[model samples]
Target: MLNSINTNPGALLALQNLNATNTELSTTQGRINTGKKIANAKDNGAIWSMAKMQSASSQSLNAVKDSLQRGQSTIDVALAAGDTVTDLLMKMKEKALAASDTSLNTASLKALKSDFESLRDQIQKAADNATFNGISLANGKTAKLVFLANADGGSFTVNAQTLGLAGLGLSLTATFSTASDAKTMIAKITDALQTATNKLSSLGTSSVGLDTHLTFVGKLQDSLDAGVGNLVDADLAKESAKLQSLQTKQQLGVQALSIANQSPQTILSLFKG
Candidate 1:
């Protein structure tokens, strides 16, 4: 109520009100521009810290997913090689059976023997070539493929199944020249076929497991992202409305301050009378 030329109480009061409104307007504008209610530690320290931790976890899962995918691809290569070996064994068994027939001529037996030898060699080649990323699971090159499963330092291992000729009990030196030799080979081929088939099935199962875990990791990362968003993301609609209201208040505050600053002129008028 004091109207003094030296100090205007009304102007000081209006300036304080205007500064408060400006602060609120600045905050609202920040939320709208950044689209985050807690953009930094100053905005909301506790919530921002929590969101950062969750975001780190989500980012770490990206590495885990990559590891799992690499493991899956390695297993898939092994499975493909095992399947080829199995097929070759089956074909070799057919050739040996044909050679086992006593009625077959010497030339016919020799032809069948040649075909069997070629098919038998392919099994070794297939196993040796089952490689991915410089690692092989079928030729005794690698014992297992281990991959990260989670952000908590957990892992999964896919044990290797060696499918080499020696590993499968198949002899590369075995001959199929006579009926008795051919019968002997048939037995060995049967056992090798069974072993290769089982190995392939195991690898297939491992591939499926890797794929499932990878999908789960992806979903978990998405959930973490959503959690972070819930903690810090701004509601644009609400912020927009608040921005408009604060802008109006700021305009009104300026006008009020201007009127208060003119109060010294009123004191002069009183003296003029």
Candidate 2:
């Protein structure tokens, strides 16, 4: 099927070479502009699937980090309130000792009792108000926090147990009327202070444990983020180098196609002979 007019083999070959060069140039340009080997899901289904999984995992890790931060803050508030309550209880104990001394007159003893009552009220107030994000960490309220790890299929829960004055057996309702009664109240207050101290000590330990866990969770989140970044993030330096190389190859490809088309042009000179 060779029925064509003015079909100089040189022109036909030049047109074909030009078309191929243009296609290669367009592809290289697209890659340079997009800065990705597979910019769309259709380009590389497997890579895209893995990238989506990494993205989902990164989001989950961020959520866990937020939860751990809130937990740490709650524990911090509870520990501070516990310290305040402990201090007030110690002051009340001192007042009780003063009231028990008969050397102090009735008026002085009555004032001392009033001061002790005020301190007890303060202790209860602190316990009641120790809260974080509307979640009370003190006053014997229980809460459980959980952390999930996807890779290891591991999880752990942290419980906020009773760390209140009542839990420490510190009864703030005891009455001190007579000097002897005041002495008995002082013993009770002293014992309660010791109990509260021990509980605060325990709370301190628990708070430290929570802090440690939070730190561990934070590190894990960071590592997960890094992993996700590695999966999908672009290497700008490498991409830039590739862009330069591709541009040079595209230029050379065009020149080579021009030379290939001219190979058939040598036949035109034979016709002149």
Candidate 3:
């Protein structure tokens, strides 16, 4: 109630309240602008730190996904080539069976031999061309390929299979020159077919494994993103409502301060009277 010119308690109290309202208004405005309640360490240190750590982990999974995808592609290439070789071996078996017939003419036998050789060469070509990223799983040269599986430094190892002619125990000079030779050729072709089939199965299994893990990694990354959002994301609806209230409070605070500033003038009126 004391209205001294030098010391006005009412004005001081009004200023204090106005300053408080201004601080609240500033905080609400910041939340609205950034769309985050914990935009930085200053907002909420513990929550912000947790969100940042999870975000980094989610980003790291991107590299893991890339590695898994690359591994899958390589295996797919090998599988395709192996399948081609298997089909070629089946055709060679047909040619060899025909060549083994004792009644066949020389011209027919020569034609069968030519066809068989062409198929064998094609199988070798398939193995040679089954390369992806400089890695040929069917060429009997590449070692086991490893891909990152998760954020914990774990990995998936894809074992490579030997699918080339020599690797499959098939000699390049294997021929059907006579009935006996044709029977030997038949055995070699059958063995090669079996080997190629097994290799394809192995590669197919690895592809499936990579695919399943990739799906899991994607889901885990999504969960991490959601967790980070829960920690730091702002509720725009709530912030909007709070912003309106704070703006109104700030206006009222300014008016109250104005009225308190006029209390000193009342002392001048008292002296005049």
Candidate 4:
């Protein structure tokens, strides 16, 4: 090889190799620092795009879970109101029976009537308080609670069962003026009790269904998150090993470049007078 400073092919080749090694080292260091193989679209276009899509899906599923929670709370409030109203109806029924008996005196009948009136009023109060997030499912304020299940326009709708006194056909506002009146109200109260019980059962089932759907959504989100991780998360162990190797190669590249640069000085040795 002729020692000529004007034409240094070895130096050019060594510089090119060093530049390549530096690029590899930079990439490996980025992976180590960020712990992501695809931090941007430039990393791996296809994998980064797929991971972003999965991340969006996971976020949507989380939103669905939140909706399910609100739906469940609304239904639960209605169910609790139905339970209270049902209990009140049972007490009212017993009061009606006691007042209807011929053996009961006028004062006894009046006392039973007063208790029955109070219990009946509580049913309305329970229905009023059953509202959740401004939704009165038990009192006929709304027809249903709709929860989004996914980003694909799917949903879960729970039909509201109005368990109010008017809803149960128990709107006899007049107090028991006589035994006959008390007897007449018993049948209606019995029906209302059964109706309220049925509504509670339905609401409970819907709440359980919502809970189940939330569980399913959580699992779906976990799967999507794992998919995103698989696509973009770096294997630190592998990256660390690569980092060590790149550091070694970077040093070797520097040494080789240094050796190539020194070749031009060798031409001076021929003229060393």
Least well predicted 10-residue stretch by lDDT in candidate 4: 168-177
Q: What lDDT score is found at residue 195 in candidate 1?
A: 81
Candidate 2 lDDT over residue span 201-241, tens digit each: 76567667667766776777677667755655556677667
lDDT of 4 by residue, 171-260 (tens): 648468799989988988888878888888888888899999889889899999988998899999999999899899989989998999
Q: Candidates' TM-scores?
A: 0.96, 0.79, 0.96, 0.94
- Lowest lDDT 10-residue stretch of candidate 1: 264-273
lDDT of 3 by residue, 1-273 (tens): 555899988889999999999999999899999999999999889998999999999999999999999998899899989888888889999999999999988999999999999988888899989999998788888878889989888989999997889977797776778777887889888888887888788889889999999999999999999999999999999999999999999999999999999988888888784
lDDT of 3 at 204: 90
- Please provide, for model 1 over 1-273, each residue's C-alpha lDDT reduced to its tens digit, 9 standing for 90 to 100: 666789988889999999999999999899989999999999889999999999999999999998998898888888889888888889999999999999999999999999998998888899999898888888977788788999998989998999989878877776578988999889988898888888888888888899989999999999999999999999999999999999999999999999999988976667674
After aligning candidate 3 to the native by TM-score, how far in Å is the CA of 10 from where it should be?
Answer: 1.9
Q: On a 0 to 1 TM-score scale, where does candidate 1 land against the true structure?
A: 0.96
| Clashing residue pairs, backbone N/CA/C < 3 A, model 3 | none
How well does candidate 2 match the true structure in TM-score terms? 0.79
Q: 2 or 3: which has the higher lDDT?
A: 3
Q: Give RMSD to native, each candidate.
A: 1.3, 4.1, 1.3, 1.6
Between candidates 1 and 4, name the one with more favorable lDDT.
1
Regions of candidate 3 where Cα sits further than 4 Å from its true position: none
